[model samples]
Target: MRTWYEGAIRGFGMLVLLSGVGLAGATAARAASLDPAMLPKIQAATFEVVQAKPTGDTLSYERPLPLELLPYQERTDKYYSIGTAFAIGHNRYVTAGHVLLAGEASLWGPPELRDAAGRVYPIGKIEKFSLGKDFVVFTLAQPPAGDAALEVDASPALNQVVYAVGNALGTGVVIRDGLYTSDTPEQENGAWKWMRFSAAASPGNSGGPLLDKDGKLIGVVLMKSANENLNYALPIHEVLDAPSGNAEMESRIAYQLDLFDTVENSQLKARFALPVGLGDFYREFQSRIDANSDAQLKALLARESANLFPSGAGSARLLHQQTQLDGFPTLIVRGSDGEWRRAGGQAQRFALDGNGYVATGAVANNGLVRLRRPDGVAAATFYGDAKSRMDLLARTGMFQRAVAGEKVKITSLGKPVRESTHLDRWRRPWHVAVWPLPYANALVMAYSLPVPDGSVMLVRFTPPAHEHDTMLDLAEISSFVHVTYQGTLAQWKDFLGNPALQPATLKGIRIDFDYDHRFSYTSPRVAFSYPSTLQAVKPDNLLWLGFRFFLDGGKPVWDVGDVNVWKDTASDDHNNVNVQRYVAPPPGLDDDLSGRWRKLAEREYPYNGVARYENDLMKINAVVAPAAAGSQPSTVLYTAFYGTAGTQPQADMKGKLDLLTKDMRVTEH
Candidate 1:
């Protein structure tokens, strides 16, 4: 069934082999103090092997382990190959079996021979022996070096002094003295057997020669264990004493080489599976975290914990953990059996309270506070995937906008304390900010109360739109969200789970526009532009408008607008305030959008026939158009904002949309 070439390839692939080029390039200079007289022989034995990885940069191979670390050893970049080799044959050479067998496939399709000068010769013939036997024999199609071949011995005396030479983990060739100890077979993979010795070995040391007292080849050095002085070598005796009739070695080498190609191909696939964009973002985030002070970071963490409510049956808690595995933070839970497992998804919503003793959030029908400890221990029962918890929390409504210069309070068993400050919400329900905090640890439990209250507090209020003061270098672009609210502050105290807040005090505040909002809407009359490539995919007129009104310190309350305002107002005072228009329909889709303007107020209407204030309004024409082809062609338009009689006069805004036509250029408008 299998051809001779395949068999040779298989055999060659099973054992590691090094190239003479890498060995020759090793840092022999570092060993200069040992003996210059022996330098030529060491150099002569050195070789370099160039291994081309499927996706990463090629790795360079070396011979004899360098006495000192080499550039390759300290290289952080991914390499394709590992070490070097030496001249063992006219075209034939000796190298470690492990190098060839490192992966599922071999570097050489079949056994290959390399000379001290760097020429390569494919093995025309090859022979393989058992693990204890260690050595393989091969005939090269051509000679790589003209140097005379070294003799091989079938057996060498135990505890005899020997010089093992080969690329030791890509280091240059150098001699080290050690005693031949013992031979041990590996249990997991039987193909490789250990040649125990006192000499040290590195990654590039594979496929090197172990010479006896007379400089005759005895075995091929392979690896060393960190825990012990044991080293491994393949016995050269087997190659010199194989049965004359057995001749499948070369074929095996060829098959093995082919396997190397298969392995490299799989490596390429794995390399590309990672998301590069996300990786870049992560780097930026890490930089920010490193720059922040510890104290500020602690407060930021507490706020983040506040937004993420508890889920399932558990009091909410914020916990943190670090991992050996790289990348973003992950949550894990220890099972009842004491095994750490990823926490369930349902538990992620909760927050830590009462010194993190209980987890609490929006609980289901069953009353229970589910939780997981930072060390992955299950503090309470869980029923969801912990991995997706952060994702869900990041997408929360609280992070949609920033609440600045506002009075916020929280209270638990203690009195409520309030403060006036600015708060920026993340795009997700929960926010993870890099603030300054002294604690090096990750988890904490905190509670919110009415302004100035130290007790637990639940807030029930909605966010509002704040006017941009254009004269003060403030312009509200489509990319930013502005919020302003004149409302009473809500207060709640001494409660767990979800507490309720009642209107307590009126406080006026304005939040600066942040360039984080994701939604955008343009008047019908404005024109839009995009990159030429994207023009075909995204046309125009994709508008989505949403607004909210909440108590000074509250959650984002989406609108039923003007209707709610009028309903809450006293009937006698409603006429004076022109509240009748609160129930008006939303603005139309076309240029005349007065009705839509009326709906922006958070008011509600129960009956349809009511003629809300019909006489007081101005109309503006708006349109959106596509961009033409050009390097930086753009569409520009003027938009107007207006409100009812009693409201403040809205400002006029101008905008431009740009579409780049060139390839590989940044997109800007």
Candidate 2:
């Protein structure tokens, strides 16, 4: 879970939670002088927008809710506050548009209003909405019977003492007083004027009433000023005079894509008839959200098309380069010199229960987690159980459930809302699962690949409203993920047998092992079999197989390119063997590598082609596979090597290979 500082509420957007921190002045100095009847009327009209408490908590906190910070009675309430809303008469209530939008895709019960007496009222319809001005007007399904609405006064005098009333710090309605400091032009345009005041605006105060000395409503508190105590409020006239029959929302969203240092600006505007049910409005708003986001994405890409991949000199060089494929995903950036290179953070391991560890690398807008399958969990069970997989990730702290900017206990995501698979560029099948975060209007996605020991997971968040585009985008980006899969032969058997986790590209691959001392790996390009003497073939032995890209008839294809098998032990001294697909140099390459390539091709054409060498530091035995019709400038070089730890006994290379290849069968396309 992430840590949040109170004054600067990071994750909850503009819903900042400010407690009794140092204000512009002391509480006594900020108190207002209002008529005795005014406070009661103001309090009655103002209601705290909230969501009903769930029957049981899906969220568990690192510590219990800070109940000690609140009054005894409020420590355990039936509802939690979201923001403030107040009656404007005529069954219409007003609040900050963002406050209402918080409920847009939330799983928390739809936005409701709680009165000073603790009575909860349902919101009926969204009568009017405006994203640009940040104000919303809606009708209450069952407004309490009484004359609780405050009188609207559009032209309250400047420099007059006023009370900013709302659920400050979520401790009921707080009336902090200050002067109407001045008038300022709204940032978007000078089309409207905002009432600047000296009173402090807490997070829950977003849609509260700004009352004059006589209790006349002048404005609705909206935001805190960044540079000064002159907080901003939308003049009541704006919300009161918005077009009556239709709800129009227009906003200019400043958005940027992850990994690329570029921004896309787009204006989103929509209009629909008022008196519409909350559900219909939500559908319309979500539709517009996708259209606007799509425009921004397209424009972001189109603006940099010329310098993008496959277009500029940087991209051309990158395409010609052979990437080393066994690392976390990274951003391919174009340098000032027109060269492309990968950028990423080093991996850091966080220990979890059992032998499992969460190996993480920091990246923008997304998370990368490599979980070491815990010692006791069965590989087959982990791969087949979706809830169990997510529950394991929940413990990693990256998968979380939060409220009021505080991290909570997340035993599980409950269940995945959707599950599917996407085959990455290397033909590795990535299982994709999405869980809803209705409270946040977003969804958490886990794109995972099951390996021998655990899973290589790519995680990110998206608005569930944008599901279609988000899924497509996720599939496209999956091509960039880089990870390695390795474990015991027993683990591999369990991993490969799950059809739900396998993609068609992996259908042609085969891995088999038996207690009878036989082991083998097969693919469309090559098939090979060897006995235990080749490299100790046991259920517990470690094996690593990875893929690499090659130009097949000038069109690139990924196939088995590297293989490793070894008897891993507690001590550093151990024997290992591998077969690597070594590509020959292209034109203009350096001479040293060219010479090495020549020797390898020559070694393959004639002779038994077995090579062996020994030195003070290590022992080596190797051979190059014979050329075939479809074989490229790439050659398969096999090696069995063991380090001597300077003075330890060196392996008898010739003796090991003699027994290794004695019963080996090889096939090449």
Candidate 3:
């Protein structure tokens, strides 16, 4: 959203960086080899911080794992190496706060320690923690027998030899020597200096010990300089002198909602009693961070209150504006003038087997994709079927390749980890789902709305912490999602019969179909019923219903604006009839159609007219029906610019128009 905004709810994003790729908050410097006697102790004291084995494998992988992912064995390992931690005292261990926090809310199981021989030990109490400093001191549930703790060196001479040791790249413990470089102030408040070393530390080295020439702890390696081999490590004294039973988490947080680039910065400061188990500490940490996020969001909302939606002058203008008939969700943006404008993405299409295709594009931070049902898939199965929905989505080439650094073949997406439903501003129900990207520290979220033939979907990948904020954004945006259902009469019958398969919005809609006898559709705003003889909806007949959003009594609303029915082109010659609604002519512009409707609407009785424009390509015909804004009607010149279209009595079009309009009703409000 902005250069300053990391957009991960708060600073937990910092953890993803510290423990990913070849990143390290460490530095390099001169090194002198340690005495041979220290080798065994060094290895024994360090441990790989990993997630304990889960009860079961939840993911279904492609058979004969993708060749590009050469070492799929590690990808399937029960233990997931997160970072490094080392013995600092009898039963006590130290690691980066970020490393330990990764397991918070993770499905990967609790954090534990893996020794040189792969034996595992559960982690115990979190004795101390510092978010800003990025270090943690804790204990093991069961310490290795007779294992020695590393010696501490509070201050090591600059330019002296040092070693950065840990489970570098999850390949097991490794020792890399370098020089003790400069001392730089920690970025947030610079309350203390961090020992910068030139050690070749990598992602897995975080929480590992940076040792002096004598094998004593110089610092706890945390992160690497953005552009250099020099890395950062927390001084050992910071941990040694800290209160044993407290957590001091203070970090500078910057944030911005996805809609705009406006940013707000705040320092999150919270202190709570610790020396407690990891679960208890995490609960307190998350609670405080959530509060901080609320404050930041409130501040941003307050600053923009005068220009926000539905309450500002800009909102008034948008509400008064005419409906955009193009059915696709759009982003509501505030321009520099503080005027609200709709931002819609360009349509992009991808082909699939049969006549199936996917049309999608980006709307600001969100990617919007729309797909029509494939011929082989049943309409019943496509509705409210999570597995089939995601599978169809994956076929659109959205998410099937690499997660983190490993590439795996994806024949199927399996199922979402979480699934739920949300009702939009229009009262339409939408499907929401979240799928975890194994090892990626991220999630793929899908917001889907079912249409007659297919669905309109919103997809995005977010850092785990961002889910709450993202969901709120998606929920509001769903109201702006434009959709028009179109499908074969056969598909519609099967689809309309299942209320449980419909979103709440569709639940209120009723479709009566007496095969080869009668067909009718009724919604809150419109209704039409016709016998098979008037408009025969054979099993293969096609029907289209388009919805549009407009303001009714200054309140935004969405309803049917267009309806079209036609004979199946596959079995018959082109034949169609359509009825469209035009909202009342807004003040100002007086276009020809608006002027015609205004004049016709002035009649005392219901107005009716017909026109024919014949061309070499084809013959066109239309009938106009206009009536007064009924009891609750809107001046919405949508004031009777409405009517019905059906296979008319070819010989008496006028008589047919009168009959059809009598059987149909369209309300502009």
Candidate number with greatest TM-score = 2
TM-score for each prediction? Answer: 0.31, 0.79, 0.78
Residue 495, model 2: lDDT of 70
Output the better candidate (2/3) by TM-score. 2
Off by over 4 Å in 1: 1-46, 52-81, 84-90, 101-142, 145-147, 185-193, 240-669
Greater lDDT among 2 and 3 belongs to: 3
Off by over 4 Å in 2: 1-30, 58-71, 189-191, 255-257, 298-358, 374-376, 393-413, 422-428, 434-444, 460-476, 512-518, 525-529, 548-558, 569-573, 584-669
Candidate 3, position 659, lDDT: 41
Count residue pairs with overlapping backbones in model 1: 171
Q: In model 2, where is the ten-residue run with the lowest total lDDT?
A: 20-29
Q: Give all candidates' CA lDDT scores.
A: 0.30, 0.65, 0.68
Q: Write the per-residue lDDT of candidate 3 for residues 1-669, one digit (tens) a residue.
A: 222122212322232234633222222222347777787888888888887545543345555445445455464556777788998888989998888877776657778888877788888888888887777888877888995799888867889988998877777777888888899775555688878788888778889999999999989888775677787788999888887777987777775765556778877778899788878887888777767766777788799776666446666555544444443555666666766667666477767775666777787778888777787887777775878877766665555566446655565567788999888867776889998766455678889887766778888887665666677667766765666667777777776776654555567667776777776767765666666655566877777666655556666556666666665635232454455555554555337545655654563223334423233112233333324455663454322221233333334555434444556665334
Backbone collision count in every prediction?
171, 3, 28
Task: Report RMSD (Å) for each prediction in the order shown.
Answer: 25.6, 6.1, 5.8
